[model samples]
Target: MNNIFVYCEVTEERSIADVSLELLSKGRKLADDLKVKLEAVVMGHKVTKLEALLYPFGVDVIHYADDEKLFPYTTLPHTAVIIELFKKEQPGIVLFGATSIGRDLAPRVASALRCGLTADCTSLEIGDHFDNKTQTEYKNLLYQIRPAFGGNIIATIINPETRPQMATVREGVMKKEVYSVKYKGKLNKIDAKSILKDDDFAVTIIERHLEKSKIDIKNAQVVIAGGYGVGSKENFQLLFDLAEVLGAQVGASRAAVDAGFAEHERQVGQTGVTVRPKLYIACGISGAVQHRAGMDQSAQIISINTDINAPISHIADYTITGNVADVIPRMIKYYKKNSK
Candidate 1:
């Protein structure tokens, strides 16, 4: 185990994705535990500017692939170049953000190399394991932990036999931090054209429509979430008003999304995005296990619901028993009065 590689996903803005930076932060810890270098794999048409940003996150070596065909994320070319590099380097561990591009690319590369891949892992760590069936003691294995059975249980997966243990982690599941000192590591430029053939590019991109999303609850420091108890779509406006005053992002449970009270991107749960905000105010939420799996890790939880027996109240740091409509307005008023 020489190096731990993070697949750095570049955004359309010609910047490194926040999830990749988060992975780099976690990978640095893993690399330190294994006594190995933390490396990053960055591929884009013109990603020269993105290379420098990775060092602050504690990247030791950057395997960079810059070429025209690599833009806009076509499956074949990106997969081909990564597979070629993996074959050559044979990294000890590889991590990918469980985003659209990462979900598409990781499985293909794992399949091509005949390696195991754990998708949508919420936790990753290095440890020792004992295989009872094989009677083998595996040391320094990457533990890929995720929610299983619809977030009712957690499962830890290990690829003991694979050379490069791989896992895809969702954004915001891990914290991101920069090292105190900048990493002066090696940057190896890879020639994408050398390994990529004309036939490898089966899919052609005619045009790219990049829509700017307004909501990013995963990165929000304070999240105010609603559930089916919020009632109708119109009543969801209460959440928005509360969020506005609190300077928090609005989140919803799976029930809220399914009931057409909110968008899927605004959903926070096992089936949706996992969030670890500094403050989580769960209003009108029943606190199902699925919903808790996503936000139970918040630093502080304030559950506001009429039902004292709601599952959310059990884990919440503060439980407010009241109607969301009645409670939110008073809170907003108090906040305004106190601030003034």
Candidate 2:
């Protein structure tokens, strides 16, 4: 019998990915529900250093696969490593962070393993089940639930026919486990094989640049997102002012970004950053499925739009129906007066 496996996408220095730790936190509950042990599976050069952090996150075991060949994040090599691990470990459930790398690697791994995978899943729980004569006592019985059809309905997916039930969950939807010094677990260094050759993949890294920011939107405590309704690039300054007063980062909708009002990096949609801030203030943006995919995980959503019927208003915890140009200034005034 295989254990529940969570993929730990390590950074260049071998620190665990934030989303990977979140998966372990979620996986820990799922493993307990199914009466199984939670295991962390890491792949990269010198990944053994990560094992010490997994136990505090409730992992019962850590499987380390270290190879200099696995240093870079490439689709073919990373997917090949995960596929090889699956064959050897035979885990019943596998969880991946729905990051750029995970999005690329997961589909290939799922294809190689011939299994089903749920992507950008916001919510996951063990599915309801009925006893089946053929259903293994501990396998393929849990249903994977996630938001679908633009958060209008919930879809429950089951891979009853497959060995390992796989899923890629969006970052920030699940909480990360804090390091606890009290809990301790075992770490095992595994001998893993490199299944891909240099020529097997056509992609190569020529140069890499990472955008460093003082405030990361995904980890921000407060976010103010501008929508198409913000009107023009100059008008975005008002939203930025509000963000500054509230100490929040600015986010943009796909429409706003495409209109040249903002950079694509600031867009909040399926194609942009997935954020779950404590407070998400949507100004003048109509809620589209793609837009909601990124910000719906926020702890509290407040929308200000001219159209009360805008799709985003429906999901907001509080809705103020009015033009952003008119509404935002009033809010700024009110906040300043009461914020003594």
Candidate 3:
């Protein structure tokens, strides 16, 4: 009754979403720490042979429901399935991806279950908390950590009194790994007709349209990012030039995006997309806590700023004190020269 559950999101391509896979990887660790079996819930059509994809992530139990209405992911029927299943299982902890579907489904589930829900958590761990007023001790609690007070501070939140401690994590915040390629898990088929009702199909999707993203910065091997200190929108061109020379994606801080120096899609921070690149070059970024939470995991960091004491320089493997306008051009020239 008290196991860790991950809602594995399935795409139209009949594959598990990357964020769900990453959650499974983390869920496996949490399950082990709690000495409980890791469980997964997959609701979609034609989701057979998913064991090949899931077991390696250390899932001990898989609750799968296959029905025609399950695909294209309507809000009502899908939510009904999860709500019913969660009630029967009474899990201790539940996790969801902070995607469009997750953002929609998780709150409903939490509200129905009368449980607390934390959104956009950057970190999750098992810890203990003690209440002084009640003189109560809580052990093995799920710690949902994220930025609070407008990203000025990091807050570690815990659900000491709630069952199925719930949180929705962002993509790329957790690393994806296979627990064991040889690992195996048992599957239980859910009766779709028994659990779902006609009223659940009130909302029918008529048509679906998806616009492909122009830039895939998340998967970029190298990232060259700029901030407000980059000067102006025209000055941001230097970052683009450097990116082209290095075959890297151009990223920006929230300040740069607010100043119209870069597009919103290119922003990297708590409110923006999280990225883990092999090399991250920070140009004129003062490195607020929000921005660092997104890119601190980069394999190597190099910060260049006019101020020698910029916050980003603290975490940089190499810090160059200079103007981005001058620094970026020289970088582009030297990189091109070295390539030949």
lDDT of 1 by residue, 1-340 (tens): 4489999998888778888999999999999899999999998877746656888888888988988788878899999999988988899999999888999999999999999999888789999999999899999999998878766788999998987899998877778898745567779999999989988888898888888677899889999999999888888898899899989999999899999999989989766788989999998999877788789999999999999999899999999999888898898999899995
Better of 1 and 2 by TM-score: 1
Model 2 over residues 1-340: C-alpha lDDT tens digits? Answer: 5578988897755688888999999998888788888998887887544756788888888877777766667777777667777898799888899887788888888888999998877667775554478665544355776767755776778887686888888666678865465667787776645466776467887888765445467777898999989999988988888988888899999889989988776877665778888999999888887688788888999999888899998799999988788888888899999998
What is candidate 3's local distance difference test score? 0.91
Best candidate, TM-score-wise?
Answer: 3
Q: What does candidate 3's lDDT look like per residue over 104-201, in tens digits?
A: 99998898888999998999999999999999999999999999886789999989997989999988788999999999999999988898999999
Give the best candidate by lDDT: 3
- Cα deviation of 319, candidate 2, in Å: 3.0
Q: How many residue-pair clashes does candidate 2 contain?
A: 1
Clashing pairs in 2: 127-143
TM-score of each: 0.92, 0.85, 0.94
Ten-residue segment with the worst summed lDDT in candidate 3? 209-218
Candidate 2 lDDT score at position 215? 47
Clashing pairs for model 1 are none
Best of the two (2, 3) by lDDT: 3
* Total backbone collisions, model 3: 0
